[model samples]
Target: MSPSKVSTIAWDSFHNTVDGKPRGGKEKHRGVNPATGEELWEVPIANQQDVDDAVVSAQKAFESWSQVPMEKRKEQITKFKEHYLNYVDEMTDLLCEETGKPRQVAEMETKGVVGFIDFHLSLTLPEEREEDHEKVMLTRYTPLGVVGAICPWNFPIILSLGKVIPALLTGNTVIIKPSPYTPYTTLKVVELAQEIFAPGVVQAVGGDDKLGPMLTTHPNIQKISFTGSIATGKKVMAAAASTLKRVTLELGGNDASIVLPDVDIKKVAPELVMGAFQNSGQVCVATKRIYIHQDIYDEMLKEMVEFTKTIKTGAPGSNALLGPIQNKMQYEKVQTFFADSKAKGYKFAVGAPEVEQGKGYFIQPTIIDNPPNDSRIIQEEPFGPIVPTQPWTDEEEVIRRANNTNAGLGACVWGKDVERAERIGKRLQAGSVFVNSWEKPTPQAIFGGHKESGIGGEWGKEGIKAYCNAHVLHTYKQK
Candidate 1:
């Protein structure tokens, strides 16, 4: 079946999409175009009453949705994926306007969600297990009911749908609450889903700070999947505790990359820099720091600095490869790190050390040359376009420094020999370790944080298990 052009392509943008329909909310707030520093448009804020409508509807729908056949569910989800692709280019346009992402990068995020849906379709719940003696006992996987997905501003579309697809496919309903900074695309996608899904099967609500706690604390929500800073993730966990809801929190990371002496500088420099600054260094797993073997420290730094010359930072609509920070709070937070770096007199190897005032929240990509291990820029998540590099005389010492942080989301190891790289990669204290290139996580791999990074995970069969409940059924011989 084909998607109706009128219903699938058009989005009002001003209202929240709830229970498969558009409606007004308690209040409204305007989102700014980080590229131009102009108000893009006003969006509704869901108050307590609106939240009640969503949860009530979701609970009501769960009665039938949880009973639908898996094949039938897959058919509807496939339709949603097809409709999403049809609307993706338009979604990218809105994403750029609101999130200040380069058009290509934004398109990647929007389309990546489609890829995630495709991967989830290949997955099936564990087959029923039986143990027999005088009787039989079985294990079954069951949907946990209504799920609340709290997405972050960076990669808003993919991250939100990443949770929604798995939850819905597992026979659970979903209520998506994207970060207020970049809410439109996710809401629009959910709005369009009304055509393919039963009312209340998929929903989206946009709002300020209060909305998150309200959704998390809602006793009816069986699970909460959150992606954001470590602090906020902690708050989400705490709030969900009152309801004893299951949670999957993918929090922040101060990931580090180790560059061994034998690797070619030219081949790895560009990938290294891109890994650190993609999405303006706003990614949770983007390598925030680099450790180079002393033998190649100077050469690696030199090549990385020269490569930074090719990156252009400007409006997302322009040919620029990098765009502004998505919001004022994050922009100013990054500025504080910039100021601290300057006060401490660290030497910059690329771009200017100063934060230039612009109409938008743009920061020129800057690199610090071998700053002290204790430097705030190296130790903390700046979440902007600044990075730090340090030299290591011993392999063990460099690994120690990289593992020093409580963050263990992801780390990288670069070496000419693949086996050697794997050896070093395994020693790092991250959930995922890249041996050579810092590529994005594929749908097949499970991703989450260790230590303070996060709890639970996403993608792969292991991660999707968070959305389900395992039950044991017992059978006995009858007379």
Candidate 2:
């Protein structure tokens, strides 16, 4: 398993289909490889009619699938997982090509997709226990009719699985509208899923977001789960309101990574670099804001800079450690953060806006020093690789500033003192936090945000509950 060995699986082309009829959306957009500036493929931008067709398909499937026994459904899903697991190479390559993530990151996420399927299997098949006596009782979990999922581009395969699998496990049918920027990869995965699950039970549709409202507000859909920017997430929520649909949003984050004075920077630096910019900083939980104790700030910055400089950035299959921005808009957005920060008087400690020679949509791994709290780079979620590092004199003050943002998705604390890290982790408003390690969405753990970051989580037993509607049953003894 040499790191240099390039791995790519040849995946079949994805076509837009409805009821086994191959169809194309009203318009089409080109999916480009940001690393090479090459046009990789074109994805059809679905129209209102296309959304209607998909939703109808799902709604129709729910009628029959919802009646299927849970054990039988689990058996079918297990076979789906088997198929999905066998094609890990294809899924990994598709993700790398579409999202511009390095091969290792792609493989990691491919593993995540498999793990998500396994997680749903674990949660959906809770042990059936006998309750009080003469009156037979069964606590049942049923799906919310038709589930609509709007997936984000970063970690598309894994995030899609997080939402789609849970909905399916609960006996609900789903229609996924993948982020057009990275739709093909997920579509291919779903195409494989169609083998075990019926065509309508699990489906994917790609299109311009303008059509999303139609899916959200459709009369048949009972719940909506979305993973993307806060702005877009709000839009989805507003639209779902028309149908009074149950919704779960996994949105934007300006997650802060607090570096306590006694923390080990040598160990922390590499993790922060990966956490912040693993996918060119396109991650929602990317460590955007870093607060460090003044005593160790300078030394930590040196280590962070040296570590960031060592990462190689290039195409997906390259021997590089980092990859290009997923798209041009993201590249431009990263540049704007740089231009605005400098105008507001921030110093660059590691890299600059000007990318290396011949790099395509690739910004150097940047670390800004002591930017003002009010600055856009600090106050707003960067959603890119640009991170602002500031010095905090007091522990309480650091927690206050970290929780100041409307977002509360994730946070990280680094300190050699375990007790101090735990104390700080408790005060943070984020849904998830890691002490001495950066944020990662594990299948067994819960993942979501607080406030504008998101409404509910999307993994673990709690995550499965989001897709199900609970009913209470009471029995009266005969007199």
Candidate 3:
């Protein structure tokens, strides 16, 4: 679709939903199409009052919803899943316009939500265990009432559902607060939930800045699940501490991929490029640094630069393999790294700084060669499509360098020698390690970050349990 066509499409004014009904606010903010830099729609800027109403709605619903049988909850989720699948096409277009990601990426995210829902359904809650004949202990996992979910702009649909599905299945009511940059698709997701679920079971509110703090600090909210930057994660954590609310944070990462001398340069170069530049490297787990064995560094660099030249970047819904950077603030952040690289005289193996004529957050995919490990591009999470590669000779030295970062979300090892790769991958200080692949997270596997990367995990049996509070009931016979 053309930019004008996308801009002129009838857009809905997203507002807060409390008790399954739409409520508007006096203040409002316009949604921008990042691809064209055009205003798409105006959504309500939720104030403290809006946050109060949303939490109250969730609190009221939790009392009754938490008591419903697990089977009935599964049925509701199944019905919602069917509805979501039927509306995938429409949702994909909305996602593309709001986030400026390719249609394929949007569809991939839409399809991934079903796996999370099904995983929650397949689980059986913990049961009572007989410690002995006379003494019995029952382990009960109870829901935390009135959960508040704050999702980031990138991958809004999946991340929002990532919190909503598990929290709802575990019998907690939720109020989702989506980032102002990309709130349309998430609001649509919550709108669909209203049709299948009872009032206040699942709700959403959109805002620029004030709404988040209100939701996080609200006394009525018992748990907070947040996915965003570490700086913001810290703020959320501090705010939730006042009420001692349960918090699960999935934050930033500066992931690395180690390439040993045994691998084929042509085979892994393409995969590395995709891992580094997917979503314009806006992903929290996208590979940020690459370490190649010094013996094969030249060969791998040549192959990677050649492969990167073949890929295209442009607006969404086009033949472009990669889209714009999603917003102006991020666009500026990526530029700082480029400027620093130029000032420090870093070697650019593939891309250089350039200016686009029109209004869009566009940046060419960049690859730097052999920058110092302490450079800003290597140390900080750019959250954009610029990656640096360095050469290392000794395995011990490389592993130490890889583990040097405070952000340890994901890492990868690429080589033909499985034993060596496994050994090296195990030593990396990351939450998830891949043998020959990168950024591959499944619903059944546990995913999270170590150190400053994140606070809690998601997308496994443990992920479902993150929303629950364990209550142990003990029985003792008269002695």
TM-score of each: 0.97, 0.93, 0.96
Candidate 2, 176: how far from true, in Å? 0.7
> Which pairs of residues collide in candidate 1?
none
Instruction: Tell me which residue pairs clash in candidate 3.
Output: none
- For model 3, state the Cα shift of residue 10 in Å: 7.6
Q: How much lDDT does each candidate structure score?
A: 0.88, 0.80, 0.87
Choose 1 or 3, whichever is better by lDDT: 1
Question: Which residue ranges in model 1 land beyond 4 Å of their true spot?
Answer: 7-12, 128-132, 477-479
Name the lDDT value of residue 66 in candidate 3: 97
Error of 2 at 258 (Å): 1.0
lDDT of 1 by residue, 1-479 (tens): 84856743555445687777897765888888888888877788898888889999999888899899888889999998887778777888888988989888887787778778998998888867676666777877899999999999988888888899889888999999988898788878887788889999998888999999999999999999999999999999999999999999999999999988899889998899999999898899998999888898898889989889889998877888899999999999999888888899999898776799989999888899978889999889999889999988888888889999989999999988889889988888888889888847877888888999999988998777788999878888675
Candidate 1 local Cα displacement, residue 124, angstroms:
0.5
Best by TM-score: 1
Candidate 2 global TM-score: 0.93
lDDT of 3 at 339: 90
Higher-lDDT candidate among 1 and 2? 1
Candidate 2: tens digits of C-alpha lDDT, residues 176-245: 8888778887777676666567768987777775867878888888988999889988998998888799
| All-Cα superposition RMSD per candidate | 1.4, 4.1, 3.8
Full candidate order by TM-score, most accurate first:
1, 3, 2
Q: Clash number for model 1?
A: 0
